[model samples]
Target: MFTGIIEETGTVTGVIRHADLWRISVAGPAVSADAAPGDSIAVDGVCVTVTAPPHDGVFIFDVSAETWRRTTMEEWRAGTRVNLERAVTPATRLGGHLVQGHVDARGSLTDRRESGAAAELTFCFPEKFRKYLAQKGAVAVDGVSLTVAKLTRDTFSVAVIPHTLGLTTLAEKKPGEPVNLEFDVIAKYTESLLQFRGTGERELSEDYFSERGF
Candidate 1:
């Protein structure tokens, strides 16, 4: 799991495509400082395992066709900057919400502009995932955990601080750029429980509605 907090910026050194698989190499200093074979790393919010561990601050990961079909990494070429994060340990503080490093869906950047002190980034989520979004809810855009600032039928927005742009590949995002998105898993579970409740309209478990625990 990840915290959706970017640790370092890595640059693509090579992309080797071999039929159904592609091997990508990136150079990251902090994330690769103690890296080893079989470790997991988050490259632009997508969890990839280390096939060739960092040698001189470089790491390599193999991407299959399934991953290519689901993420923007297929569009990556040499010199592309990517967000990199090593998996957090049990002792690490949970600064951000739980991130599975699994990309649920891909979103396209529909609009971007400066909103006074911050940048307003709006991404259009497909209709299938629209139900998972809500105003002020959590959304992971390219590994960065951001709050949903606005919501529309097909679009949602987030306010990006200057530091966010500087620390991750989101700074490179422009119109039409595809980003990996993971909605809050808690929301999904909550909605499912609510739907089940609404079906039978079950009564309270205990004297729960006694006005502040009675």
Candidate 2:
């Protein structure tokens, strides 16, 4: 679990091809400070295991083919900036919404508008993901937690503050650029529980006791 708070803007140091997998190395100081082997790190919104512990704040990530297929990491180049975040701890402050370091899918940026002190970025709403999105909902794009400022049939916009622009890779995104997107996990869990409630072949209900074959 994570808070969707970006700790560092890590640079992609290496990209190695092994079969269909990619061994990536990212350089992040804050996140890699207490890093150890097998630790979880969110790189560009995807949770990757630490194959190599931090060496001078650099961490190595081992990514699978399916993970790359679901995210924009496959387009990463040397020096590409990515959002780096460590898992949330009990003592850590919840600065942002809950993020699971899981990318649901990739979306393309379609428009950008400037507000008084912020910028509103609109991205095309993926057909399958539309059901999960709504105005004022939480959405993690490329690992940055943002609120949906507005929603349309085919697009959703998010307001980006100055800090977000400077601290995360969202600043580098341009129109038509692809970004990794993760919907609020709570939404998925809630929908699952609601949809499957009492719909099983063997219906279970509070009105019927266990012995009554409810």
Candidate 3:
């Protein structure tokens, strides 16, 4: 799990292609300072496990075919700048919303409006994800947690303050650029429960609650 608070920006140093997966090396000194093999890190909002120990602040990980198909990993190459965040620990502060580092879908920026140092970005995602989005709800874009400022039938807008712009990659984003998107996990769970209830397969009973100590 992660808090969607970007620790630092990393640069892709190498990309080795394999039949089923691609090995990627990223240079992030801050996030890779104490990272070890098997540790979880969020790279551009996707949960990738560390494959090897850090070497001079560089870490390696493999991206499977499924992950590439679901996210914007295909666009990654050497010199690519990516948002990086280490997995949250028990003592970690929840500075941002709960982020699983799981990308649900890929979206592209459709418009960008700047006012002084702030900016409002609009993106259009798949229609299926529309049900999970709500005005003022949480959304993670390229691993940066932001609140939805406006919602339309197919697009959503987020306001990026000057602080966030300097800390993350949002400031460099341009219209038509792809980004990884993860909607609020809580909303997805609630939708699943509602659908399950409507199925009438099995209803939650007092006995069930008692058994689980709920």
Candidate 4:
């Protein structure tokens, strides 16, 4: 799991295509410091396994075809700046919301406006993901955990402070650019548990509804 706290922005140095996998090399000193083969690294919110040990502050990863279909990594090329985060450890401070580096979907930037030292960015995502959104809820966009400042029928917005803008790729994002999104995992789990309370095939329906007078 990750904390959605970007350690630093990394630059893509190489991308080599294979039959069913692509080998990507990224240069990040902090992220590669203790990284080893098979370690988990969140690259723009998608958990990718490190395929090779870090070499001169650069680490390599193998991206499978399925991962390509699920994330924006397919669009990555040399010189692309990506948010980087290492897997959280027990002793690590939870600086940001819990992030699994499992992207739920991709969204596009719809609008951007300045708010003094901060900037508000509006995004439009898949309608099916609307259930996971709520005002003041946490959302990870491109691996940066942010709070939902506003919500609409098909859109949501987050306020990005100047520090966040400077440390991550979010500042370079333009309208219509794709961004990977990971909804709060706790909310999804809550929704799943609530389903067992309703009239479904689940065994807890009878006992669950009786206590709540459903």
Number of the top-ranking candidate, with lDDT as the measure = 3
Q: List, residue by residue over 23-119, the lDDT tens digit for candidate 3.
A: 9999999999999999999999999999998999999999999998999889988999999999999999999999999899999999999999999
Q: What is the lDDT of candidate 3?
A: 0.95
Error of 3 at 101 (Å): 1.1
Residue 65 lDDT, candidate 4, scale 0-100: 90
Clashing pairs in 3: none
Going through the candidates in the order shown, the clash numbers are 0, 1, 0, 0
Q: What residue runs in model 4 are displaced by over 4 Å at the alpha carbon?
A: 197-214
- Local accuracy of candidate 1 as per-residue lDDT tens digits, 1-214: 9988899889999999988999999999899899888999999889999987589899998988988889888889999998888898999888777887888888999999986656999999878888888899888888888889999998999999988888887777899988998888888888888887888766546664574476
**By the TM-score metric, which is better: model 1 or model 4?**
4
Question: Could you estimate the TM-score for every candidate?
Answer: 0.86, 0.91, 0.96, 0.91
**Residues 103-133, model 4: lDDT tens digits:** 9998999999987877999999999999998
Query: Each candidate: what lDDT?
Result: 0.87, 0.87, 0.95, 0.92
Give lDDT: candidate 3, residue 129: 93
| Candidate 2 local lDDT, 1-214, one digit each (tens) | 8888898899999999999889999989998999999899899889989987689888998888899888998899999999999988899998889999888989989988777667889998577778888789999998888999898877889999988888988777899899998998988988887777748644446754556765
Pairs clashing within candidate 4: none
TM-score of 3: 0.96
